[model samples]
Target: MANSDMCNSVGASPGAIQAPPLPAFQPRSCFACRRRKVRCDRQSPCMSCTRNITDCVFPAPGRATRHGSTSAQTPKRKQAHLLSRLQRLESVVEILAAQVKGPAESGTLELDGAGLVGQGIGKEGRGSALDDKTARLGEELGLLVIDENGSVYIGNQFWAAFRDEINQIKQVFDNDDRQGDIYSAETSSLNGSIPSDLTRQRREDSLLFLFWQSRGQDVPLKDLHAFPSQLPIIWQIYIENVDHYSKMLHVPTFAKRIQDLQGDFSRMTPGMEALMFAITMSAINSMSNEDVKIKLHAEKSDLVARYRTGTEIALTLADFINTTELDVIQAFSIFLDTVQTMESPKYVWSVAGLLARVAVSAGLHRDGSNFPGMSPFNIEMRRRLWWNILFIDGRSGSDQIAEASLHEEMFDTKLPTNVNDTDLDPSMKVPPITRNAITDTTPILVRSEL
Candidate 1:
């Protein structure tokens, strides 16, 4: 009985003293709150945990050991680092938006043959669009249109057609078979040869011949004299040619024979005056030495004294040479004689040939060469050939001339020779021979074989 009482007193008796049960673990808020050293409310379905805020996770029951504490803190530290990274990302997005909304807007982007927004399109449409844009740009810049075709023709289409018609006229003039005759025999035979009294009739016949030769297009004879303002640009060129030629023929020539020409000289008109001045200037220029400054000055002084004309008279004569008048060559020859009292040896044949054509046009001769004194023409042709040689000599250097001379000799001898034999050394310069030296030293009538 004493042992039983002692066991009860020491809680050895059954159910005398039982140890208290451990308290159940209640999870706190998330790991983020704990790492931040903030107070966490021990709640079920915690606000941070339910919101997927893993940073606020609480420790598990019986995990309050030293190892458990370190493991819990690691997760909390990672969650806190991740939150800081997310906040930095938000700040970057806001800064980018602010920069984009600033004052400097994007500049205009330029594209090449393909326009802006060059996306899906057919090949043909793309090509056409590019061409249209190019053309528009060219027009804006005032640039010439150089397409696969040729130059742009913005004027009347009639002028373009008329140009084709005039080209045919040039072809007729260039014909070799109709060498001497201005008018074909077939046409001349249709119209009888009228006397000088029928001047009006002759003019009409000439106008018809000109029209027929030029593409046989129908136009009024009256319209030939006064071309219509509405006529095409090409026809304008023809009309101008006709007017100039008509005026040219009416100009009287200086007396071929002194006694028979006095009456003609007395009846001189404006046309005659212009013609005479042109002829005199051509003659003077043909015979003039390269350095004929003294002669030109003297002629100017004489013109001022006798004709009381300005320097413009000489300039006008030069302008006339470029004209398409039928009598230009002959008129120029006559003028040449008047300038230098000496006969022209340079252009006599060309003048004769041109005159023969004029005479044939008048139904006087079908062959111009049949006219008397073809000797002067022959002489002039030879002189022109030599003149060309001298001109070439003046322009080329010594080495070029030496090579040319050697080539000529080799050809003449019909032998093979090296270029070295020609002595084409550029170091040796050759002074040009003066035009006066060529004219004075060379005999105009010299004839050599080969």
Candidate 2:
């Protein structure tokens, strides 16, 4: 009857659900620690195991795991091991957090592999800013840097000249859409043939058509000086760096003429046009890519390409080879100077020889003192040119890995007067006597002396 009662009780719970299978236990303590009832550092051979000189083994997961099983560690030892693992996990998480959050919150950008990154701007926001506003627009340590807000920063060498006006000039940037994109033809096959000349009907405007004739195509006149607004920005860069060093242009008069004719390109002589393009090209060449981005908000390579093409077109229009024009030669000189470092030595050598030939033909090699009819002002300008040509020739030779194109006896042009710009007026009769110790002219004087 008792056996019958027990059977009835066992059958009574037949409808009840069975318990889920127990998961395997992953042991944290090494075999040595488990045997000695001690903690394990969980290293390949734990510290305690190392000191005791015993075999260290980790427990592997298995299907035989059970809370009631007597084959493994006591509950207290298992709990201690679990606690140690939790602490290690927490510490790793903390180390990861520290690595993610460095001190400064400012955004920064790194461009190219040159390591020239721009410092980022502040990230603080206004009342309307989103909660996730900490994200940056762009950040880099470039030659020039801009932040999310579009504030620009350039190097001191360039900024000193135009820092006062670059902000207001952003209004001019709105008109950037007006400028046409310069297209570069990418061809798979070689096309060496030149396009035929413009029609006779189109050639009615001979001078205008002449500019395109030598360029070997029918080009729009409006395309000649594309960005008129950027004239001030680039002109300032040229005057500050190149003109200050070269002393080629008479700043007092030349600056005035440029300002007057700036609004009217049709009134500009081809020689002057060439000079403008060459100056702007050199101005760009003097700057880093970053500086171009901040000031012009354009790529350095693009600006150089456009202005260089313009220079070639303008020089062709001026008939630079056959002309006795000072502006054309001066333009040639400036263009050569700008390209000396940027172009291949072989190419620069060829251009340098071309400049030397034009300069010699213009009598720039002879001393101004040899001419009786020339004014002191003309003499001074000629002296500057003569010496500059020689300098260019010497540099060109160095580019070609050779000596100067001309010997000492070839030209006797004296060094330019050390007088200030104020001293040499076209209306002046006698030359200024005393040379100023410090003037804008002072630099070119030192260069000539060298």
Candidate 3:
């Protein structure tokens, strides 16, 4: 009676009670779950196993507890626990999918040749999605593509890719060779080296040809005479070149041309005299030595003598004006127009002073009665006259003054008589004695006031 009472209290039927049989294990869930740490349902593609997305497999039937009694309850307990774990996993996967696919998908998706559905690419066929994307990117950025076979090809943007690939290939080849001799030879061949002197000569020849073509028959000669004032600028270029290249080559032709130009200035019109003077100054500045200077000065003296003789024989301003040609007048006008606007006021003043001396000698302002309404004391008229004389004398220079004096003496059939030594600075010194000098000198015809 006592035994029966104890069995009843423990809820056993006289003997120990056997546990109920556990469900069969499945291969679709993990062994840890199958051992009843969690349940592995015998579902083919089990819900707990599939939802967790792990490599699901079962442990052997006898692999649980030592008595084998716990094995019967293992599957049931693991299935229940796995069901709860799977529910949590499914929720986590849903949260991840939502996070990945958010507002970005609301906009239009760009599709390339790759089989990518979203930002995460999916591979299809023989080529991977990554491979296809790489190829597309290489093409866009003008990169070269190297195949699995070790062959190279211009991916896209053909020219740029081709150039880069070629350069890289060359660099590799160059490294293998180690000696840069081949590269140097190729570069030399491509560039075709030339001597610096030859290059300079070629350039100068080209410029000379151009100038010759533009100037036609006139070239050096006509240009020299046509624009007497610009002679200085022209001479400057020649002089600079001569100085630079003197050791390399003699410029005898250049020197001869310069000499001829100096001679030509004497015959220029009175209007262009200032331009000639400027040219003379340029020649003086360009002379290499004292001998050249003296020669130049002597030539100037001869030119002045001829010009003076010619003008003095004319006897009247009309005669002088009539003797002048249109070309001479035009040339003179062109020169004056250029120099009048020059930045150097000294040049202007020098030209003006020279002109004043010439006009006074020419009898253009005798008793101040020649020009209508002009006064000896009229500053404006005097200034205008001064400018006119300056323009002429500056272009002609002292040579022209000497020439006029010589002409006057020759026409009168006498030598210059008034041989006074003028003060070097008119305001600073008295005129020198002339009586003794006049005895041996030729007589210069002095015109009376009109």
Candidate maximizing lDDT: 2
lDDT of 2 by residue, 1-450 (tens): 999998778768878666553223222445676577554555666788789888877655332344444364444644454455446446534532332222254333333333223333333432346233222222211122212211112322322222213322232233233321111121111122222244323333343332232345445534856477888888889888788888887878777888898578888887888888888889998989999999999899888877776776677667676556778888888888887776677777776887887776665765443333346887788777767777777766864656547666555456787877777887777766656587756776777666
Off by over 4 Å in 1: 1-258, 263-275, 278-322, 325-450
**CA RMSD (A), model 1:** 41.4
Rank the candidate models, highest TM-score first: 2, 1, 3
TM-score of 1: 0.18
* Highest-TM-score candidate: 2
Per-prediction TM-score, please? 0.18, 0.51, 0.15
Clash number by candidate, in order: 11, 10, 25
Question: What would the per-residue lDDT of candidate 1 be over residues 117-136, giving only the tens digit for each residue?
Answer: 11111133224444553343
Clashes of 3: 25
Ranking by lDDT: 2, 3, 1
Q: Compute the lDDT for candidate 3.
A: 0.33
